[model samples]
Each structure stands twice: as C-alpha cells, then as structure tokens.
Target: MMKYILGIAALLFFSCGNKEDILLPKADRTIVKEVMDLSPIYIFFRVNGKDTLAEVNRKNSISTTNWILNIDKRLPLRLVIPEVMKLQEKRRGDSAHKNEAAQNYYSYADSIGKNLAFIPFTNVHYKMVKPKAEVIVFFDKSNKIWVNGLMIKNDKFKNFINEFIDKKSENYQFCFSEDLSFGNYIQYEIYLQSLKINNGQEFIN
Candidate 1:
C-alpha cells in the first residue's frame, strides 16, 4: 500500500510539472511572432521623422537589424547584429546624394527682359496685326485666356490684373504695353489655370 501511494504521488508531481511547462509563455513571444511573419527587406518601422536607424532604436529598444530578425526568424544572427551600424552609414550616404542634387538645381538669369504686354478689357477689337500689335487679355472674376485650345503660361495673371485694375468702372479698361524695343512680335498664349485664391486668399479679379 505504501509503495502504491508513493508511486501515485510521483506520477502526479511529474504531470503537474509538465502542464506548467506547457503553459509557460515564450519570452517576447508577441514581438518575436510579429517579426517572424515578415520579410527582412520589406520589414520597416518608422524610427524618426523620416525613417532612420536611431529612430528605430529609440522606438523598438533594439538595433534596426535585431528588430529585423525579431520579424524574420530565418535571418542569420551575425547579419542581425551589424544592421544598425550599416543602416546609419546608408542613411548618411543617401542624405549626401540628395543634397548634391539640390545644389545643382539652380539657374541664374543674367538679363530677364520684360517682353510681354497684358491688356484688360470687357470687349476690344479682336484683330491680329502683322506684328501682333498687342496680346489683349480679357478677364472678369473668373476668366481664362486660351490659344489653340491650350492654356497660357501665367498662373498669376489674374492677381496681376486685380492688383492694378481700379474698382471704379470708369478705369476698368486697362492697357499694359511693353516698349517696341523689347520685341516686335512675341509668340505666347494665356490660359486660366484655376479660379482660386492668390497668396492672400483673396478672389482674384
């Protein structure tokens, strides 16, 4: 009877121990599982304002490479450890390249001649002259000029008219002419881009 009681007690102890072991949650299982299901190259989390190594560390409490492994269990341990340093170098190189490109995108105009005339009127004699005397532009609150069914170059022409045109009806007809020395005939067309606010958010004339 004593032997049977001892055997039963040992069996119960072993079974309970096995159950506890089975129930024990794996360390960082949530984080590990989340990482394991993701591919290494596309696995990304925003670290800072744009996405850099430091931001990853600050947010994830680990290096960027380690974070990669947490998502990709197939990653070699050696590769995971050096990811942060490598990413930092890559980020620095990318920034330098962008800066270089921006530096090269500058143009200086030595002489910008005023070679265009802008005229405002309700109705003017629509005549094409030999030298194209003047390009007459018409405008109300929402008017756009077009040539051959294509819009013109100036997006802020409405603002220019509004600024110069007098509110009084008597001064509604305004003529803007460039000196003949600028050019005999310039080829250009105007189109209404949008009926929206200018920089001041005021309705353009």
Candidate 2:
C-alpha cells in the first residue's frame, strides 16, 4: 500500500526495479507544488533506547499497526541526510573515480535513487538521536514545516498520544491509508488493535 511506502523504505533497503507501473497522477502536472498543508501526515514513534537511523527505520516497519505523529517534509541537514550527502560531497574532490571515496560516493548516489523512493516524493523520515521518554519532541532543520515523512514534535500532542496509548491498548502501532475513492487523498491512520502481528502481520486487510 502507498501508506507503508515510507515505512517499508525506512525498515529495510530492498532493491526491486527502476521501472514501475506506478499510476502517477496523469495531469500535465509539470510542477507539483510541495504544499506543506497538502503533505501527507507522517506517523513516527519512539520506543525506549537510542538507535541509529537504520535501526529506527526497522522499528517503524515492525510497528506497522502503531499510531503516528506528523512533521514537516523538510529535514535538517545536520541529521542523517548530512552523512549521506557527505559521502557524495567528499567524493567530488576526486579527479577521477580511482579513489575509494569516489567509488563509495557514486555507490551511495546510485543507492539513493534506487532506495530513497519517498525522499524524492518529499517524504523525509525523522528519528530522534537520543530520545527522552517523557519528552516527545519533533525535529526540524528549519522553521519551514511540511509533511514529509518525519514524526511530530509537539509536546502537548505527543503527551496526549502517549497517554492515549497507555489507556487504549498496549500496542502503540498504526499505519497510513489513503482515500482511493477519489484516486487520491488525505491519509488515514489505521491502528492495528486486535490483529495479531506475525510473519504476515503486515498482510492484514
């Protein structure tokens, strides 16, 4: 499903194919505005410990039935993006592709195009480096907030969600859904309440 598009990418790096039968909105849409208000509602959560960006992605995939929080699409360069970007930036100094840095750089660039499918669509996922359990805060590189793929940063809302989870159910899981009736939509949040998660847990209908 399109909703899990970001989550799956976050979980693991699976290379399928460059060519797809994705039914992109066929409007002479020369320019699709990166409308902040029009962005998808990203759901992000924090468990107990500190983890790398790669680990966080895995958690997101595991908690497919959990709830979420939204953040702007624009991510901070100081975060994971910088490391990935640096991989490429350092390689530019190489006069030729004979250096290890250059090879790694080019490999990273190719991997991005193959892996970060949602980033291009403006869905930037975010995770806290050192998480504070009580303090549920969102991260942003700049003031410009858009709904990319990051989690929420509001204290009040974050607390509210945590409290809601405590009282409602133990599984603080959820996933996004779209209104296909219009062939497009404002995303809908689906919480996996009773459905048991298994090897095919994600196959829930």
Candidate 3:
C-alpha cells in the first residue's frame, strides 16, 4: 500500500510539472498577449495552418469589420496576400450595403489605403518615441518626397536624407497624400526603415 501511494504521488507531481511547462512564457508572447487582450476579434496564423476568417465570421462575434490578423514572419507572402485580399473584398462588399458617403469613404480609403481608420489600442507591439527635432517627410500621390517642406526628386532622396542625418536630426515623421497608392506607401516605409537614423524612430500621420 505504501509503494502504491508513492507511485500515485509521483504521477501526480509529473502531471502538474507538464502542465506548468505548457504555461511557460515564450519570446513572442508579449505581442500575442497584447493583441489578444485588446482586440475584440483576431485571427492567428501558424506554421501548419491558420485560423480561418470564415470560422471567425461564422461565430457572429465580430461586430466591427476590422479584425487583427496576427501572422508569423516565416509565413510566405503568397499565402498571406490571398487572405488579405479576401478581407479587402469583404470590405468592398460591405461598402455596397452602406450609404453613399460611407461608400465614398471606403473607395477613398482603398485608393490611398486608410492610415488612421483603425489603430492598435495598446502600444505593446511598437514604441512611440517623440522626436527632439521634428523632421517631416511627406509623400505625394506621384511618389514624390518632400523633406522639411522642400520637394526632393525620387532618385535624390538618399542624398537629401543623408544631409538631414548629418544635421543630427533625431525625430522623423512620415505623412502621405490622400491620393497615394498603398504600394508606394509600403515601399517608402521599407526604404525609410533601412536608413540609419539617429534615434531610429519614425511615425506615420
């Protein structure tokens, strides 16, 4: 009887230990936890597969059109684009049933991509650092860039920006025109990210 009790106690201890292992925090848990805690509706992407947008829709818990799509860095662009397009398609379809003003807004947002339509409730994923000396970077619809209210040619951006960095500019803010394409906006964002800024910080407005 004594041996049997000891065996049972050991099994229970191991079982609890296994459960604790599963609850341990991971490196990427910060963003995941933040999104889960703040977002009313969110879809998580995984290596093997992902949670379907259809599944989320079917649940009827999503009251808003916006949903957080949490994707892994390793996920292929080909796999992700189709899903994103589906969301865009749904947004377009939703606009059809709305009033004329709402429809127009949707069209406008699609044309330039809405920058402020939705925002993260928490700043856990990224930091918002105030710049010491604000240097404004504006992008027009024609892919033209303006630095500190001065127009600079597309090819001359590197040279123009280097001057600012040389001046020890610590703060950078990016602004987009209403008619700018989403692709152009993303391209510039990538380009700016590769630059060696003093504080390595930029904000979109």
Winning candidate number (TM-score)? 3
lDDT of 2 by residue, 41-63 (tens): 23122223763221112222211
Clashing pairs in 1: 35-71, 36-71, 47-55, 145-190, 152-191
Rank list by lDDT: 3, 2, 1
Name the lDDT of candidate 1.
0.23
Could you give the candidate ranking by TM-score, starting with the highest?
Answer: 3, 2, 1
Candidate 1 on 1-205: residue-level lDDT in tens?
0010111101111222331100111111111112222112211222356533211222322222222211111222122224433443443356434332111000011112211112111112221121221222432212334322334445655565467534433333222122111111111111221322111111111
For 1-205, candidate 3 gives per-residue lDDT tens digits of: 0010111101111222331110111121121122221112222233335432221221322323334433322223334334445554554556445322221101001113211122221111112232234677777667778877799888888887787655354466555554443334444544554564424333333
| lDDT score for residue 24 of model 1 | 11
**CA RMSD of each candidate after superposition:** 30.4, 18.8, 17.1
Candidate 2 lDDT: 0.24
TM-score per model over all chains: 0.15, 0.21, 0.34
Q: Candidate 3: where is the Cα deviation over 4 Å? A: 1-134, 166-169, 198-205
Report the candidate with higher TM-score, 2 versus 3. 3
